[model samples]
Target chain A: MILPRLVFESLLNRRSTIVLTLITIAFSVALLLGVEKVRQDTRYSFSNTVSGTDLIVGARSGNLPLLLYSVFHIGNASNNISWQSYQHIRKNKKVAWSIPISLGDSHRGFRVLGTNSDYFKFYRHGNKQQLDFEHGKPFAALFDVVIGADVAKKLNYTLGKKIILSHGVGKVSFSDHDDKPFAVVGILKKTGTPVDRTVHVSLQAIEAIHLDWQTGYKNPAHAVSAKQALKLELEPKTITAFMLGLTSRLSVFSLQRSINQYSKEPLLAVLPGATLQELWSLFGLAESALLIITVFVVLSGLLGMLTAILASLNERRRELAILRSVGARPWHILVMLCAEAGLLTAGGIFVGVALYYLIIIAAAPVVETRYGLTLTLTGLSINNVCMLLITQVAGILIGLIPGIRAYRMALNNGITIRL
Target chain B: MKNQFISIVMLMVLTACEEPVNSESLQATWEDLIQEGFTPKELILKYQIDTYEADDPRRMQLIRAMEEEWNSAPVNENLDNKKITLTGFIVPLEIESNAAYPTVSEFLLVPFLGACIHVPPPPANQLVYVKMESPIAMPNDGEAFSVTGIMKTESVNNELAEAGYNMKGLSLETFSNESLNPNTE
Candidate 1:
């Protein structure tokens, strides 16, 4: 203990250099730990997005894409399912209810989902069912709109507010759907899902806006006003896809089979749970990679700390010998040095964790918008606590080399050259 | 050190025995399953809609599950050729040229087999969209009997998920056209 006190004081005397090194090591540890925490928490948030829904039926596509467009409000469906196909599947005895969806349109950067009220009625996610209202209710009439939690907050919208649909997604939206301006009817609570950032409208609205427009984009040469569009037939001929639920649980397979085998359309049915499981397996590889990266980073930080202290051993030899001559035991000196190294590592990790929380609080909105990932600044996890312990132990073990050398040199020097 | 090594070996052994969630139904060819006494109910729960078009609370759960099953299958493209029964809806894709179902002809098969999006190789939980020669109309709660074709993966079009494992081609046969299986319950 005495030796460690002396060493801490000695390092303190060269406070400028030592403090710089300590800050560097602390930030590195923070980076390492931050990476690990973000990786784990993001995964948890992702996996917990939709828990209650039993199935996620969509056009035959990659599981990730299907999930993305349907639930997350990211990307666009490759094709649309025929109304005929959706109707046939919906009529199946096994189907409970259906939520018909028409995707591939956007209002500003927010995605516009062309879906029926059944989406609000029958949809379930995370721990709860039904979309909770942050301000208002679901759109009751056609041409009405319902904004997500983020959309509402970011745009500062209220009930009955009118907004136009942008032709494209992101900052630079091309031709606007000025003719079919939708009134904000609902504001959904923050679910930390993509829905929070989306603009929900009836399937009719989707068809109404695109009645005269061609695929990809409308001909800018023949742009029509919103009032003029009202007079035209806004009936939608095609939609991105439809979500089907069977009346009876047993009939889902038969219904899916029916849909897939449709003679008129090349279609597919998918169970959300099954595909989610599959997608998770695919992500498992990334998880392993993340684990490896985190391990390497943490190891590197510990090694750097060890290297710095060990390099300073030569300067500390005289101090150790002086202590030995003053009746300090060699073993005691070793313990003190190891303790100080351990304390430094533990202290650095602590600061790193604190910094991560601060960053999360600051960048929550940015992460939500760009990456579509929702992060919560919570307390330390058991895993993180374990990491702290591991850091402490590693610090002590690495310092052992220098600690032993100092002890040996002190014993050899004896009272003759205590200085 | 020796004890530590043994513990690690034991942990590895235990972890390796975990069961994968692949469909455990009879491994019949895609045609055989369709032709046989098809049980739609059992298959529906196993192969439901994959509302993973967007990253919502609903889709995230599906993505996680799909990722879990991506490792076992090396087959990604040409899903119809795999000779396994798939349960899904009739979704017309946007790729049909002069087909019966024009707009929604090229579609995906989800849930049971999700082609991974961002994940490198597509998850086996999805099947990529493919075009059939003739447009296949869906019977209300219908079932088809046909010999699925072989695998074909290409980097031509942007698919449902982000990347990896896109469906290329398929052969759709109407059930009324043939009696591959004679015996009926």
Candidate 2:
């Protein structure tokens, strides 16, 4: 309406001042939107870490640690469940599917998971979606390997490539399984989870490679050669734990109770969702810290906006009085003033989203290779939509005080003979 | 009143087919036994110290010595027939590079042994994959425990013929059974 023209005219007349105000509003919008996008993406990434998993059963340990080791691939497990216990739990009628995991091995810095083909068939990420193959297929016929997307790309692996494993779980591996090289059979599609950085092979593969080793060193006196070692049986005696899925969700608790209370052994069963929540609980302090930082940033932006606008408004008294003398309504002045805030905020939001999308696209490879977390450029998640709406509402509300003052100024000027 | 009547009817319908078990207490749901004193080891089989931290010599010494007991012979169900208490972490089993066979969800309990950060690495055979039918709460504090359970070992495998513990009938774990299901609420 008339307010937009008035607002534009005011902006044109004082181009430099309005532009500065607009810039400030734009930065605020960018910060708010950018932070919101990151938060939403973080939650999205976390939820997708272990998709398609019905349950992650492990030793009776803290949920976060279990998740930290199993899903996020951070840290290591403190205790191990007895191999005997794993077999008994797997026999339950409710367990329709399961995949055993063995950790504490690494190739270079990437984690080495001693698993089987069941992992390739049943394991999923990114919202219960099955793992898609980028190149090749699941590892089979023993000593064959499957690399994650990030691993293959970073290491520049091709089909039927050979790689060595280390005795330890990190970059500085002591004993390299140089003798028992593995062939790459498959490369997984990008999963946006920790699986991307992982190097997976059969449990038998892990054992076959390590058979001649003892305490990270081969016995100098006598040893079977790698080919000779192959002749020896390579079935694994122990593993880390397994993920399970059941036909009925209701039977989970009963099945869980059965495992924990099985008179024959000491076993712990866990639900993946509950453990993840418990793990995030310990991260509450970090979340609080982030919230505090965000609050300060928002307050600073608002304070800067308030000071800049008020300073400009004080100097525009004569213009306001002229409008009042010209028979313009006070409400019109109010609308004109607040409209500037809305416009500037909108512009800011546009720029911030553009920047984030650009960054996500540019840094995709870097983030993937390093953290094994994939960042998608899909704009405006549901949470982001809600956030933007909230931000716009907040911007408008903050503009109201300045609007009312402009209205009062117009009213006072009407009788001052300024016309 | 109409709303209340409908809500009650809906709740009843949901619970209609389920039978309640009142025989066992909730405490029994978590624990089946309490362990007694450790049976004194004869000469405490000699072991080398693969110590991670030097601060706790007692724990390190005990675990180092116990490593022999862990790896020396297969866990015998009839040994001592005396309730023995042992405290350590329930860690995930490491991938054994060479085994006759292995099964799913395999693991092994180590007595305060180090993780990736502390120790060099656990031997493959010492590792075990854990499985529990029921979900238990995981621990936040890194405290070891006094767990009591009859230990057993057996060969098992999937279609691929992996072998490991036949850990079916293990009893109540203090913690570590968390669920991954999204809470409906």
Question: Fnat per model, in the order given?
Answer: 0.00, 0.00
Across residues B75-136, which tens digit of lDDT does each residue of candidate 2 receive?
22332122223334453221111111111122333333334433323322332334433323
List the TM values for chain B, per candidate: 0.32, 0.32
Q: Summarize candidate 1's per-residue lDDT along B44-152 as a digit string, tens digits.
A: 3443435445656766665554444432323334332343333343332222212211122334443323233333432332333444434444222224333233334
- Candidate 1 fraction of reference contacts recovered: 0.00
TM-score of each: 0.66, 0.63
Candidate 2, A92-137: lDDT as tens digits? 7767798999887898788999898899888866535798899998
- Alpha carbon lDDT at B117, candidate 1: 38
lDDT of 1 by residue, A1-419 (tens): 35656767766776765565566557766766677656655655554555444345666776678876777666777777777767776776556677888877677677888887798887765544567887888877767899988888888888889999876566657678776678998899987767787898887778777765765567666666666666766656666766655432223344555565668877767655445444555766887787787677777777777777777777777766667778888887777778767767766777777777788888887987778776666667766778767767887787687778777876787756644
The segments of candidate 2 whose C-alpha lies over 4 angstroms from its true place after superposition are A51-54, A126-128, A172-174, A216-223, A247-249, A262-266, A280-296, A324-331, A363-365, A381-383, A404-419, B1-185
iRMSD of prediction 1:
18.7
In model 1, how well does chain A match by TM-score? 0.90
TM-score of chain B of 2: 0.32
